[model samples]
Every structure is written in structure tokens, then in C-alpha cells.
Target: MKGWKNPILLVLGIGVSNIGNWIYFVAINLLVLKLTGSAAAIAGLFIIRPLAILFTNTWAGSVIDRVNKRRLMVYIDILRGILIAIIPFFNSIVPIYIIMFLTNIAGAFFGPTSETYITKLVPPEKRKRFNSIFSFATSGAMLVGPSVSGVLIMYGSINTSIYINAVTFFFCALAIFFLPDVDEKLSSEKVRERITMKTIAEDWKAVISFGKTATGFMIIFLMFQFITLISFSLDSQEVTFIQQVIGLSEKNYGLLVSLTGAGYVAGSLAVSALANRLSIRMLLGMGSFLSVTGYLMFYLASPQTIPLAVVGFIIIGFFSPFSFTGYATFFQNNVPVDLMGRFSSSFAFFQAMVQILLTLLLGYIAEVVTLQTVTVAFSAIGLLLAAALMSLIFLQSKKALFILEAENNLTEEG
Candidate 1:
């Protein structure tokens, strides 16, 4: 029971976790389209949250390592819920943007802290299983949330959907209360003990001092983020294309997005089962290949063949979290426990930066070109980048082999 309790709590949290978020996503986009009717404004709104995440993540991570992570999550949940609840009450776009920004700020803390907390609770050997379960729960929430919101919107309007989303957040906050206490090492004391500008400088020096592998990993993480942002930023436009060009009904289009969630569930299960037998690097490469292929198909393939598009999107769905899990595992395995929070935060920050750039770039491209062409170009670039990265990783591993052997020899001697 003790072993099961944490996962259950985490899943419950995931259950309602994205409810408000997805609702806001669909509703707000519709709202933006209805209001100003500007494609660029819609794109800006789509990209802004990630941009917000990019700016706050590093500072949030640094703070998380120094504070209680569980508490951070709880507070973040409450704050976000409150902000979401306020959305329906406002008629002006200005307040909506403000709330969105605030929600993104809270999100920066909520996501990384949740990861840090989970890492602390789940043992390394079972990380794959834990991650799988967590993914499933979030996927479930995402699956159900939008469906529920759609029904609510049918009965009432966008405002009613926002209200329902707020209810989901309220429940999420309650679920957070059930999470058990988690112990985390605070880095502040260590910094305080050596409190000096020179000491801070030395610590920064140590971070990059580890040489190219560490630095290179961070860079790869950023690249992967860019690819993901490119994929995600096109989601709204894809739905539009399906409805406008492909002549699909809204119900059918929703099903396509839902398939992506289903793919995520399947992919998470596969990764969890194979984590022991498979090398993380192989999975990482495979997942990247899948994403690049999936997006390329969507961009270039003829929408006249609806079945092909469905299959292509399922592939995208399948690989979505496969690549993310690789990134998560990389960070978990490499980062020291004490610096997990800060490092996770820094990773999130880098991710946010990638998102911002992708959003802006995609936004600009959408102005001149079709969304399909943009997706194809973005995906092709991702695939090419992934291939290059795999080659670099192979070379890095060979070089590091001798150093690893030497270290092993020293340990044996002692």
C-alpha cells in the first residue's frame, strides 16, 4: 500500500492537472479568433505561455532547490486555480492576457517542482514505471478534460467552459494535499556558507568545468525543445486546416487530437517496459526519429488521404512523450540530487527559450506560408538535427570510454 500510495496521489493530481489548461487552450483561441480575428494575435497568444515559462524557469528552479518542493506545488496549484477562476469573470482581452501570464509563471514552478518531487519519491530502478504511470494519468486528464469542456461549451458558452475548468483546478489543489511529504536538499545553505561573489563564480565555473559532454547534453536538450515547440505550436492551425481544407467536422478533428493522447499512453507503456533492456540513448534517438518523421508526414502529405493523416498523427502522438521521457531520464541520471531542482529549473528555462524562438519563427512563417509547409520544414530540420546529434553522441561516448575505464581502475585500486 505504501508503495502504491505515492503513485496514486500523483495520478490523482494528474487527473485534474491539465483540465483547466486545455479548456483555456480551446476557449481562449476561439475567443481570440472571435475578438480581433487576427491570425498573428492568435499566434502570439499561443506562443506567449511558453515564452513566459522560458523567462521564469531558471529563477523558479533556483528557488525550488532552496525551498520545500511539495509546498511549492500546492501553492502553485492554488494560485493557478484562482487565476483560472478569474478568467470567465473578465470580458476584456487585457485581463485575459494578464491572467495567462500569471498562470504561466505559476506553471514554471508547478511543473519542475512536480518533477523534482517525483524524483525524490520514486526509486531510480522504478523510474520508468513511475514515469509511465504519471504520463498515463496526465494523458487521462487531457483526454477527459477537453471532452468535458466541449460538452459544457455545447450547453453554455466559452464562459461556462472556463468555469468548469476552474472546478477542475479546485479539485487538483485538493489532490495535491494528499501527496506525502518529500525531503529535498536545500542548496542555499551551501551557498550561504561560502557566501561570496568569488564563491558564486567558482560554482558557475564548476558547472561548465565538467567539459563537453555535460555542456553538449544541455545543448541537445535545447535542440530537442525547439523541435517539440515547433510541433506543438502548429496544433491550433492544424485543427483549422482539418476543418477548412480537409473538410473534417469538429468532432472528427477532436478525435484526431485525442488519438495523440492515446499514442502518448501507448508510448509511455512501451518505454516503461523496455527501460531495463534498452539503452536510454537508443530510445532518445528513436523517439526523435519518430517525431521528425511524424511531423514531416503531416507537413508534406496530401490531406485528401485522411487515413494517412490519421496514421501520421498517431505516430506523432506515440513519440511525443517518448522523446520527453528521454530528456527527463537524462537529467535525473546525470544531475546530483542536491542540484536537481536548480538543474531541472535551468532545463525548463532553456526549454522555454526554445519555445519562444519557435513560436515567433512559426508565427512569422504562418503569415506568408501555409501551416502545412511550416510543419514540414520544421520537422525536417528536427530530423536532420536529431541525426547529427546521434552521431555526436556516439563520438562522445567513445572518447569518454577511456576516461570511464581509468576512473573504474582507480576505484578498484582503492
Candidate 2:
């Protein structure tokens, strides 16, 4: 318990912020709809996030690595809080979109900075357990956040939920403020490098060089990211598939989402309890394979087989946390903290580009082809990727990469 103090606080802060984000998501959508009465406007909101990532991540890593991450995180949180707080005052959709994009830019910075900070704060041996706990916190927030937002909107107004989200950001900032500055010992002189185009170009080259040298790690990382993107594309079309193709009512669709959230909560609990017993190899391999299988099942189910779809949702919701915990721990363990920001941001830039293109392509294809056909094809692709991921995970040559500590190699071989 004594050793868990910082991790606990960190998880709490993250959990709070996640809940606020969900609340803001619901409120902002409602606010937009109320203002413009356009579903397309809400859809446009989705595009802003990746666009913000593309705009910021190209150079965000250079700043992330050169600054004190903890202080940077605190400042970003405060900035986001201020931005979100003022969103309700805007009656125009364009201004709201602009502000949302800026807020997302701050969020883009917060992610890698926090990841680097977590690596610095948590020891290698404890990272698996810490990440499992973090997943549970995230799952809880997913379940509670929208429900809380719904109640607030019912009792008060959308502005109330938005303001509450801003409050949560401030709360998160306060929580992060108490955390130790892990980079305090590093000389200020070492971190004061100028952020010229030459420096940024050199950083990109270094990240690419690292990827070339660490092919195994890059393969696993990119594969998992592709799988996630497929899932996202499917999710973007979920409502239409459920309502139009499956002939389900909106009420039933909401029920299905709730059940999926319940499954996530259950899975997070299981991961937290079994963190000590499960190996990273098993977590990554089995978790990804099983989760993709669930997606495949969901994609194949028809109106007459709603139960099958329900089961699929449960399986995916339950198992995804396992994959997430494994991958996050693996990333932190393998990547040198000094280079993590650059590696994460650089790949994230490429990912944003791919995401925008893939999402638009899928949406276009779904209109031309049947949604069923498009979904089935992409999910099948995910299945293949999962198999490839599992093969990579189980390879004997890569066993050393997953070990939590240098001395723990003996345990993973079994």
C-alpha cells in the first residue's frame, strides 16, 4: 500500500479526467444539435480530434521531451479546463469547433507527456499491476461518466454538465500538482535545446532509426494500432448498423451499449485480480485474438440473432482491457523514457493520417456497398492481424522483450 501511493493518485486523476471527457462529449453533442439541428455537425466534431493530433503531434514530442513532463501536464490540464469552460458561451458552431480543436491539441500533448511521466514514476516490476489498475479506473469512468452526464442534463442543463467537466479538469490538475518531479535531477542545461526545424527533423530521423533497429517492437505496436483503428471504424457505424440493418430500436441499441459497458467493468476487475498470475505474452496474444473474434461474431450476426451480437459485445468489452494493459506495460518497459515522447508522437502523426483516410474510405464504401459487407471484410482483416500479432508474441526470439525485469526472464519462458 505504501508503494502504491503515487500510482493510486495518478490513476485517480486520470479516472476523473476521463469521466469529465465523457461528460463533455455528451454535453457538447447535445449542445451542437440544439444549436444547429444537424447530425452532420456532430459528425464533423469527430474529425476535429485526429486533425488536432495531426496538427500538433508533428512537433509536440520535441517540446514534450525537453520540458519537465509533470509541470507540463499540470499546465495543459489548466488550459483545457479554461477552454472547455468557455465553450457554452458560444452560440456559433464554428467557434465551438475551433475551441474543441484547440482543446484536443492540449489533450494530444497531455497523452505522451503523462506516459513518459508514468514510466519515470513507476518501477518496471510494478508496471503490469499498475496498468491493470489503471484499466479498471478507465472502465469505471466509461460506465459512470455518461450516466452522470445524462442525469445532470435532465436535472439541470447541458451547460451544467459542461461546466462540471471543466471543474474535473481543474481537479485533475490539482491532483497532478502533488506528484513528484521525476526529472528534477536532470540538469536544466540538458533540456534547453532549441526547437528549430533542424532539431525536429533530427528527432524524426532518430525515431525512424529506432524503429529500424527495433523491428519486433514496431511490428507489434503498429499491428495493435491498426486493429484499434478497425474497431474505431466499426464503432463509427455501429448505430446505423444496429438501427437500419439489424432492425433494432434505439432503446435496444442503448441497452446493448450498457451491457457492453458492464462487460468492460467485469473484465477490468478480472484483469486487476489476475495481474500477478498472467504473463504479458498471454495477455497480448490471447486478449487480441479473442477480442477480434468477438468483433467478427458481432459483424456476422443478423437481426434474428441479437443474442449472438450481445455475446460478442460482452466478449470484446471484457477482453480489450487485457490487451491494453499488456501493450501499455510492454511499451513502457521496452522504450527508453528519453525517446518515448518522440517515438509516440511521430507514430501518432502517421496514425492520425491513416485514421482520417481509413475512416472516410470506410464511410464512403459503406454507402456504395452494404454496411454488412464492409464491416465483415474489415473485421476479417482484424482477425488476420490478431493472428499475426499472436504469432509475434509467442515467438521464442522475442520472449526477452516482454519480460518485466532483467532477472525475470526465467519465468516467461514457461
Candidate 3:
């Protein structure tokens, strides 16, 4: 199989799988809220899935590298489909929690393993384009997925959305059939050497802590994750702010979220064009700066102004892909390919762990403090962290732009 075709198929397949997640999440959150009328329960459900992912991602990654990534993804998708199909019939909170737990198990394996396959299939030179295309595919699905899920719940039923999620997962599994074996020709000896969790963890530790550059990158990446979680967790508050100030309905929340996704699509397009010209360090730094401004705008919006919030979301979407894609590409470039799955999984685990903590923390703040106050405070904290991380990137590298120069040198040598 040619390179582009494989990545394209992978993106579509993964996007299809993500739609299931999107549907399940929308249905569950809305249903739980309708049933219990409790924010804490809603938050609990959101937090539990990521917490499960945090604990399992490293182990999942280890398994992925040693086993067949394609098969693992296929089985994971199928299992998740069955789990979703089972969820709607059982209305008890206990059963719902159990099904959600199972979904998290599948998510932990599927996401990192698929990312590992992408790292292998997509060359460094083509990552920007590939990520842009992939981001657009997933984000586009996300844009539609929630609205469709909402419609299914509003018109048909919550159970209908669950059924749709199951079908989507099955289709996702079928799409996996098109994926080539990315680790196709590994020798028996090498496979045997990599079988243990300890071996993979050790490998991951070495790469992430390899030097100041690697460590610094990881720190900054962690901050990036923190900021993203804080921002997303504010979704409800954002809608509240709009409602209180401008008298918009809760429905506009979806439109604003779609705007954010649209911003991501726009950013993805630009990153595809400009990433090769910019260093990863430069891209991340600028992305962080834009995010700070965007969040600030959202927080400071006046009572009569809702468009400002929309603009802020648009800016976030536009710049977020640049930072995210740049970071992922940088990790791929710096880390050894053999350890890619482990390193990616470990990195993802830490990010998820932080997000889980922050979700609870931020939820508390939103509850105890005013949402406006919470939004401003966290947005400021996120902005400050972004600036600091950007400054450190330049300081540590001691070069204004390293990746572009490095790539140019490589090109000249070639």
C-alpha cells in the first residue's frame, strides 16, 4: 500500500470510531443530566473515562508495540461497539458506570496504538500535511457527531444514539481492515525483546528524559495539556456566560463548539501549508500566545457581547492544531521510532492524569466561585503558563528557530 492511502484510511477509520465516542458522550451526559439533574454526576462520568485512560495507556502502548497494532485496534473497536450496544438497555447508574468503564478500557488501547501506527506510516516530512488532513477528518466528524447525537436523542431517543454509536464502531472496525501492518516485518527476536511492560517503560523513560531538550519539551507539552483541559472544561461556563449576558439559549453552545472545531479546521489547513516553513518550537510558541489571547477574550467578554466568545473560540481552533501537530511531530522526530508507542503512551498518560485532576479541580472552582471568576483565573493561569513555556523553549534551544534550520541542513545534506 502507498503511504498517503494508508494514512487517509487510518484517519477515516479512527474518525468513525471517534464518532461513536462522541455519540455516547453526548447521549450519556444529556441523559444523566435529565435523569439526575446533578452536575457532579455529569462531571464524574466525564472524569472517570479519562482517569481510566490515564492508568491504562502505558500498558496499552506496550501491548500495541509487541502485538499487531491493526488487530488490536480491530478488536478494541469491536469490543467497544458491543459495550455501547449493551449500555442503553441497562438504565441503572451502576450498569451505566460499568459500561463507561469498559469504554475507557477500549479507548486507552485504541488511541495510542493507532497513533503509534501513524508515526510509522507517516514520514516526518509529510507529518504536517498528514496531521492536518487527519485533524480535519476527526474534527469534521466531531462537528457533525454531537449535533447528530443530539438530534437522535431529542427526536428518536437516547437509546437510538447508543445504537448509532454501536453501528459506527462496527463500521470503524471494518475500516480497520484497510490498514496495512505498520510494524509488518519485525523479527521474532526483536518482538520477544519488547514483550514486557518494564522494557517498554524503560525505553520511554530514556527518550523523554534523554536530555534537557526532551525533558523541556515534555514539560511544555504537559502544560499544553493542562491548558487544553481547563479550556474545554469551561464549556458549560462559556454557555452560561452567554446566557446571562446576552440571553442566548443553551443550544447556542453547540454552535460555539462547532465554531471552535471550525477554527481547528482553519488552523489545520494553515499548519499543513506553513509547518514545514516553521520550526516546531516556533509553531508551539506562537500557538500558545494565540491561545492566551483567545482565552482572555472569552473571559473578558461583556454581557452584551456573544460574538467575542465566538471569535475567541475561532482563534483557539485556528492555533490549537499548530501547537498540537508541532508537538506530536517533534516527539516523532526526536524519539526513536522503535520506542514511539511507549513514549507516546506515557506522554498521553501523564496528560490524561493531569486532565482528570484538573477536571475535578476546575469543577470545584466553578461551583464555589463564580463561573466568570473561575474562567478568568484559569485563563490567566493558562496564559501565563503558555508564555513561560514558550520562553523556555527559546531559552533552552538558544536558537530562535531550530527545526526549520535543522530540516534545511538535512535537506542540503540529502
Top lDDT model: 2
RMSD of each: 4.9, 1.8, 3.6
User: Alpha-carbon error at 249 in model 1, in Å?
Assistant: 6.2
Clashes of 2: 0
TM-score, every prediction: 0.80, 0.96, 0.85
* lDDT-better candidate, 1 vs 3: 3
List the candidate numbers ranked by lDDT, top first.
2, 3, 1
Q: Is candidate 1 or candidate 3 better by TM-score?
A: 3
Please give the CA lDDT of all the candidate structures. Answer: 0.67, 0.88, 0.73
**Could you tally the backbone clashes for each prediction?**
0, 0, 2
lDDT of 3 by residue, 265-374 (tens): 78877877776677766777778778777887887776567678788879888887777776666555655566666766776777776666675687688779776788
Q: Model 1: what TM-score?
A: 0.80
TM-score of 2: 0.96
Which digits, one per residue and each the tens of the lDDT, describe model 2 over residues 1-414? 768998899999989999999998899999999999998998899889999999999999988989998889999999999999999898999999999999999999999999999999988768888889999999999889999999999999999999999999999999999988998986777587789999899999989888888776778888999998888888877888888888899999999999888988898899999987887777878899998988888888898998889998999999999998888887887788999998889888889998888878888999999998998899999999999988888874545543433223333321
Residue 409's lDDT in candidate 3:
21
Q: lDDT score, residue 23, model 3? A: 81
lDDT of 1 at 148: 71
